[model samples]
Target: MNPRILLWLAVGLVVWAVIPFVVPRYIADLLVFTGIYTVAGLGIGLLLGHCGIVNLAQATFYGLGAYASAYCTVMMGLPSVVGFLVGAVISMALAYVIGRPILRLTGYFLALGTLALSAIASALFFEWDWLTGGTLGIGGIPKLDLFGFLLDRPSRYYFFVWIVAFACMAVARNLVDSRTGLMLRAMRDSSTAAAALSIDLQALRTKVFVVCALFGSLAGSLFAHHASFVSTQSFTVDRSISFLLIPVIGGATSIPGIVVGALFVTFLPELLSKLGDIHQILFGLALVAVVVLMPEGLVGAFGKLRARLAKRGGGNG
Candidate 1:
């Protein structure tokens, strides 16, 4: 490992440790959501950046996980781990079943298919009020208890959530650096050539899609436990759109970019809300600015700037 990288890691650890204690309770709460969003957004990032797939059905899996956790913990009186496992299994299963046909679609058509899936899932969540609790939602979801330690506060929960996010990020990094990642990139850049090489395109795409759903499910379960409630409103098409934006706004290919994007998504709205009702309009404009000016996202733009500075230093040297 690089000494500089280790140093930066140490600094980051110190900062992370200090933040919750220094910040207001609400800000700490937002940080928890940022971590949750990062986990969810990572799945989308993997698909979009590596597989060249725009998955808009992430919210469906997210809802499934939340509902699973909610119903199991509250209604069935099952253990929380059971709910997490059940949600992950169901989400992955659904993704496999849906990805087979939809993965055949190219570009916009594929995107639309995922969007339609999200719409159908949202409708089902609303209609199946008996199980889902519909507009009223499921409540009294219990907080996680690791051994005897209770994660009842936002600050405590923040660490647990981000740890999970980091684990997911590590998995994504491994995937991106592996042979399957090479196949994905080859397929993304030139599908014909990849196919000529006898790569199983559909299977590969479905595999990534299933992984994406798993991440979504995990994030949703985290959200359910953190919020202590699950509702149809949180799992709508709009939420899926927001998840999509995280990868786009941060840099789809960069793991750290997911964290950056989650921070932007979680904190920006709160910052803008101070300006009253115009916050929504301002937020929209900000997003447009990011998309138009920094097409590769904030992380990419920073990388470019860093390269430029290094070049200038070398020239001077």
Candidate 2:
């Protein structure tokens, strides 16, 4: 691990450790949702940012995990942990099945394929009344009880969610630093060159797609348990777009950037809610401004600024 990363981790640990004690209950609850969204954002970052795969159907996988957990626990009388596992498995299987063919397409075609899939999934969520409860969705999901300890309170659940989020971040960071991650970057930079190097593009793409879906699955499972509810409204194409925007706005290649983007996106609506009917317009404008001004993302822009400032400081000295 890099010394700077270690230092940042230590500092982050301290901050996370202190947040529950100092933050208000409502704020803690918001943070918990932020953590969930952060995990989903990480998945999007892995696919879109790292692998250069534009997946517009990420929310379908997320919804699958939520619905799977809801069905297993609420309908089948399973334990929370079992439901979580079942949800993750379902997401992985579905991702594998769909990714094999869909990942072959690139650019706008790929985006359109995912968009169509997400639309179909959203329609299914509405039509599958018996399983998904139509528009009302599944309710009464049991709280997560780990080793007989129930995470019933917002503060408690906040810690739990953030722990999972950080664990996911650590895993993503490790993968990004590994050879597989290097291969992914190579594929992203130039699929032709990667193919020339004998890299199995299909296999690698499938693996990363499944891995990305699993992150969304884990997050959805946590969300189902945390909110004690699962609704079709929560998992729509719009939600997928939001997930896609997080990594792009934050800095797709940087794990910390995803987290920051998630936090920003999660709270931006709430902060803008007071702006009456023009909030969405303002939000859209802000997004356009960010993309135009900072093509490499906010984190990358900051890093570049810092490097320039450091060089200037050295020159002055």
How much lDDT does each candidate structure score? 0.95, 0.89
Which is the leading candidate under lDDT?
A: 1
lDDT of 2 by residue, 181-276 (tens): 999999999999999998999999899889889998888898898889888998899998998898889999999899878887888777787889
Tens digit of per-residue lDDT, candidate 1, span 80-121: 999999999999999999999999998999999999999999
What TM-score would every model get versus the actual structure? 0.99, 0.95
What is the alpha-carbon lDDT of model 2 when measured against the actual structure? Answer: 0.89
Per-model C-alpha RMSD: 0.8, 1.7
* lDDT of candidate 2 at residue 40, scale 0 to 100: 87
Model 1 segments more than 4 A misplaced: none
